[model samples]
Target: MMSCSNERQIITNAGFLAVVASQATAGFLSAIFSIIVLRKCGNLHVHQNCKILIVSMVMLYIVHSVSITILQTTQLIRYLTYYDPCVVGLSTVICFCLRLPASVCTTSFASLLFAIVFERATALWKRGKYDAYGPQLGYALVTISIIVSLASTFWAVQKVEFDQHSVYCSTATSQTADRVMLLCFLISGVNIITLVGIIALFIFNEFALSRREFDLQSSYQLRENAYVIRIMLPLSIFQAICYAIFSISSGLISLFRDKLSPVQHKTLYTTAY
Candidate 1:
């Protein structure tokens, strides 16, 4: 059994390294794109909202990179310490350090995405009416989301505790924490769906307008709307793909953890990384 555990630990370490590499690459790309957008869109008042979203995404990527690094390292430690009691305490500490930051960043990203999508939807459906209240409503929503995220983090910290002897220290027994996590994921998914739908509607509307005899200004507005979709479409796709990869990997790891031997567990973890 001990030999099997040792073998698994080796595999898990390799997986952790892979996750670190992927995350680093993604973070770098996100940061570069964000800088480019900020530089190129400086004079475009029309793209001001998009610029804010881009900045928010950049911030999310930064936090995600740091938190994932800590989480992966701690997971590696947990795997390696299956037979070594001395290292478990350090592993637990690393996990504790990572969890809150990861949750906070995830929550913030979800909130920003929701705001961006909701605002775009309203703009599309109500047309000029959105202009009247968009900024104020967006600000209020973001503020509320942040407050909720912070409060949830505090509550989670109070309810969750480390197990000195176990590798998995998550407070899965806490119903409230689980519910809060579920709510966050639900909100994120809804936001993504809403944004995708709005983008589609905008594209269709632009096509319809192009076929009709519209005023010059109205035609220009349609063109601008199409341009926004072009930029946002790629970003939305990237985010969706990232989320899907993470979710699938996490689900498989959890589902197979109990059935596999220690070495297999480590191998799976490494592959996931």
Candidate 2:
């Protein structure tokens, strides 16, 4: 048997371990799915520009997932060794440099997911000439998404200055926690909207549009665009679920913050991150 403090320490360690495991699993799965999509996009029969948009979104998500896993793993190790598990031990410079990439990529991923659905909608609507002019629009959307995502996270980055005197470094800190929560909420809303809209579009096109007669070539193109949208539907739903989970977890952390022990708060915050 152990004392109460010892038992608490064990639980804390377990929580950190769980966060690490989940991050690792998420990174691995994202990598696998991204690779498969990259290989199969040529067969999707959508415009080449649409395919470019899809590939860009996947690349963003894969980098986001991998960077998040790496950051959280370091957080776990730092939490275990540091006196204050609620805060990180890395210097402000190192932490900012390490965390900035993941933060930027994650925001870009969410923004780009919305962009992908919007592009597909346009491509479907302008099926006749989309293949010719769509690439420029695709490139433009990608640029806009990166700019928007970076702007969204710029507020958080301002908090990432070097402070040697008793400075704490994780996103778990208040300086960043609010911004993170807001971003999660945005991601969750974006994903849910896209998921519902994608499903509705798919059903309408498959049943309503398919029932009508059209020229052979035009009908075939319509069906191919539908196929592209159909394949992306699952991905949209997956993103919705993942972001919803993160948002809910972050909400729970806020609701129970004052009531929770430092260990519990840290665990929840780190997990949500």
Question: What is the clash count for each candidate, in the order shown?
Answer: 3, 0
- Which candidate number maximizes lDDT? 2
Worst 10 residues of 2 by lDDT: 164-173
lDDT of 1 by residue, 158-252 (tens): 55545532333332223334554454456448557856765776766676576776655555545556666676677667766666565556457
lDDT of 2 by residue, 134-154 (tens): 378789888999999888887
Candidate 2's displacement at residue 120, Å, is: 1.7
Best by TM-score: 2
lDDT of 2 at 73: 66
TM-score for all predictions?
Answer: 0.67, 0.80
Q: What are the candidates' C-alpha RMSDs?
A: 5.1, 4.6
lDDT of each: 0.55, 0.69
Which regions of candidate 1 deviate over 4 angstroms? 1-47, 69-85, 88-94, 129-134, 145-159, 163-188, 211-221, 266-273
